[model samples]
Structures are given as structure tokens and as C-alpha cells.
Target: MTTLETPVPAGHRSLRQRAGNAGRRTTSDKVFNAVLTIAMVIAMVPLFVIIGYVTYRGIGVIGWDFFTLEEPPYRRAGGGYVAGFFGTLYIMGLAILMAVPLGIATAIYVVEYGQGKLAMAIRFFSDVMTGIPSIFVGLFVYGLMVSGWISVGFGTFVAAVAIAIIMLPIVTRSAEEMLKLVPDEWRNASYGLGAGKAQTILKTVLPAAAPGLITGSMLAIARGIGETAPLILTALGSVFIVTTLQGDPQAAVPLQIYNGARQPFEEGLNRAFGGALSLFVLVLIMVVAARIIGARANKRK
Candidate 1:
């Protein structure tokens, strides 16, 4: 027997067509994701290789004395990089003291109160500074503070200043971006509560962006700490462990690594490997700390 049926509506046909398109989109998304995963794995290959090679070459050199003794005489095998480690910390601490507050202040002004040519100029120069090579920055500082008649001479303080200059733009740009991420609603709420501009920024905007600020600052420090050329020109590395900031040269891991790499002896080469490994570990620790702090701040929020 023949059966009669109602014609399908245009809406139903369109819905079927949409479902087909959705299915195609799902396939495409999966393909793209797989490609991205492969690319990420490929990119990480070099990092793992480097870390493995360095660990293999340098692990034997790391011990209790490695962290407590200074570099030995030329071509000698029994010594450590205690001086470089401590000097790196000292210079970095000083540089952070000089740069972080100024960078944060500059970001605050640029975001909260800046409105004209001056603000634009500050931003323009900051971007320009970021691209300037470390060697050139070293030269600039050398000319400004070391070479001319008005010289304070090469020392830890001078090196700290140079690193601070290198760090300022990174910190400023990072902080500016973080500050920009803060919502206008938070500021409005603060204003509604009879808070002044300073109070609103301190209590609302800054706390809201604290995680990003810490991460950015830590990353900036990482970049500055790895700089060799600037420290070479400004610090004039010392063999002995120097504690004071002025009138004496300082030791740093990068300088030690550079010097060690130049030596033709096996001991020096081993020291270079050890320094490289130590530096990598230091940076890794800083990055991990930044992640933890950021996570805690997020949870608190």
C-alpha cells in the first residue's frame, strides 16, 4: 500500500546542513590541535637536550665545596664558584632594588595619570630600550660612568646600575601590561567607597595585578642575571669573593663561564660546564618560584 508523507520544512533542512558543517568543524579542530601538539614537542626537544647534556657534563663538579669555595688558580682542578654565586646574588639584589620601584611607578603614571606627549615619549623610549643590545648598553654605561673623567670606575655598584638600566624597560613594559589588565569596574568600586586615586590604585589595581607583576619582575631579573657582556664591561670580574659594592671588581657566574670557556685546560672546561649548569638551575628556580607565587595570588583572589 502507498503511504502519504508531509514535506520537510526549510528550517529543518537548514538545521541538518548546519549539523553537517559542525561535524566538519570538529574534524578540522582536531587536526589543528594535533599539528600544534607535534610542533610544541619539536620545539621542546632542544631545551631537553641542552639540559641533559649540561647535567651530564657538570654534575660531578657540584658538591659542598662548589658552593663554599672560590675559583682556583689557572688550570687547577680543585675549586668552586662560590664567589661568582654570591656576587651574582649581590648585584642582582641591588639592581632589583633600583629598578622594581621605579618601573612600577612609571607604569602607574603611564596607566593612571598619563595623557599627553610626555607619556607617549616614555612609552616609545621604553620599547626602543628593550631592543637595544646588552653590549651597547654596557658601552653606554662605560662611557657614562667608567671611561670619562667623572668615572666611578668598574665595580659591583656600576655593574648593578647597568643591569638596572637593562631591567627597567622590561619591568616597565611588563608592569604596564599587567596594570592594563585590571578592570575599570574595580577602580569604579574603589571610587564609590570614597577612596582617593592613590588609595584606589594601591588597594584595588595593584592587588588585582599582583601575580602578573611578580611574574614579570622575576622574568626581568632572569634576563638581567644572564647578561655577560654588561657585567664584563662594568664589573670587571674578580677571582676572589668580593662582598662590597664599590671600588672592587665582582664575580658572577656568566663571567666565570666566559673565562672558563676560553681556557684550553680540562679543569677550566669543567668549570664552564658547572657554571652553565648552575645558572640554568638558578633560572629554573626563579621561574618555579614565580609560578608558585602567581598561583597563590590567584587562589587568594
Candidate 2:
């Protein structure tokens, strides 16, 4: 038997040559790094400017008394934003109560259970809803409760509902992404131990995803707190603190800011600046809290 020598294919040699050529055609990664740094700075510049402006204008007015005093009658002459502060907390707490469970549950179903046309449609609509303008949400709620067929019962509850609608899709999408990040091995291990769906989700998936959920919730709270137009249409900005869910018009920080800012009085404008500063501080605090919570959770993990 004659031994035949195998030929090295031209294609293989070409590929090797190309790979070598590509390896030699290197550029310094510094250009990319420079572009990334510049992009980040550009993005952050506007945010810093706004926060700096608000702090500069409002810091003189923000004080310990700002938290304890009531809204000044002169809009700039008397007390602080104590009532507006409590009202904001109340409305946002109620909105969270209305939004979290429903949002998380919807997220779970979409992520783990739904697999057919209905899931696709739900997801498509969720994307659309998440991008819809807040003004439109305000208009829809206003129509339903303020002036539409159900005109008889609009108040804080109505405002909460509107905010819930605004916040739900955000919470759901974030939670779904977080839950999806839980490794399949975790779920598989639970299944190996004969765990039921509910037990697996409760014990394995949710704890792993807690950080993201908390962060999303904080964002929701921040978003709801600064909202003015929606609450203005639905809650109508009461002069005094509201006691009941169905109580008369309720004032919130955002609405108070709008009211004070629009008035002709110099005191009112100062109060508006002060209110904006307070809001900025509150948002910053919440963001810090979220970061802390996320860091702790990650450390535990």
C-alpha cells in the first residue's frame, strides 16, 4: 500500500494568514476609552447643572423649620412645607401599595408562566404603556373620575390609581429583568428537590432578585413624588393636609411647587425654589438609600 501525503487546504492557510494579519493590525484601546469618558461626562453635565442650580437657589430657604412648619399663607411669608411633605408621603405610600404587588405578580406571570399569544400581546402593550406620556395618563384619569361617567368619586384614591398606572409597567419590566437574571441552576436545583412552583419562586427566585425590586421601587417612589400635572388634575392640590383617602383636594410637594412658582408674589417664588430644593434633596436621599440597599443585598449574596 502506498502512503499518500494529505494536502493542507488553501482555505485553511488563507484563514490563518488573515488571522495573523488581523492580529498585527492593532490600535490602542485608549481612543475608545477616551470616547467613553467624554460621553459619560457629557451625559452627566446637564444633571449636575440642574441639581447645582436648584441647590444654589433653594439651600438658603431649606431649614429644619422647613420640615415642621405648615405652608405659609402668603405663599412665601409664613411657614414651610410640613403639610405638603406628609401629603406626598401618604399619596406615594398608597400608590406603592396599589402598584407593587400587582406589578410584581404581573412580572412573574409574564416571565415564568405565560408562553402564548396572550403573553406576547401583554408584553407589547406593556412596552407601549411604559412609553406613554404622563400627561395622557392624567387626562385619562381626569376623564374617568374628574369629569367622565364616574365623576362622582375623584380624590386621592383616584390620583393613586393614576400614579399606579404610571408606575406599574416600570416596576414590572425591571422586576422581570431581575428575575430573569436568577440562574437556571437555582430553579433546577429547587426542582431537583421536588419543590413546587410557589415554593421555588418564594424561596429561591425572589430573594435573589430583591435588590433590583427595591431599586425599581425607589425609582417609582421618586417618579411619583415629583409628579405635578397628574396629581393636579386628579387630587387638585388642597391648601391644607388631607386626612382621608376620599378627602377633599390634597396638596403634594409638586403641586405646591407649581402653585407657589406661578404666583406673582416674591415670597411665593422663593417658596417655590425652596420646595424644589426640598424635592431634589428627597430624591437624592432615596437614590442613596437604594444604592445602599443594593450594595448590602449584593454583599449578602
Best by lDDT: 1
TM-score of each: 0.90, 0.86
Lowest summed lDDT over 10 consecutive residues: which window, candidate 1? 11-20
lDDT of 2 at 186: 99
Number of clashing pairs per prediction, in order: 0, 1
In candidate 1, which residue pairs clash? none
| Tens-digit lDDT track of model 2 for 84-143 | 888888888889999888888988888888889887887888789889988889899999
Query: Would you list the C-alpha lDDT of every candidate in the order shown?
Result: 0.91, 0.82
Q: What's model 2's overall lDDT?
A: 0.82
Candidate 1 regions with alpha-carbon error over 4 angstroms: 1-31, 299-301
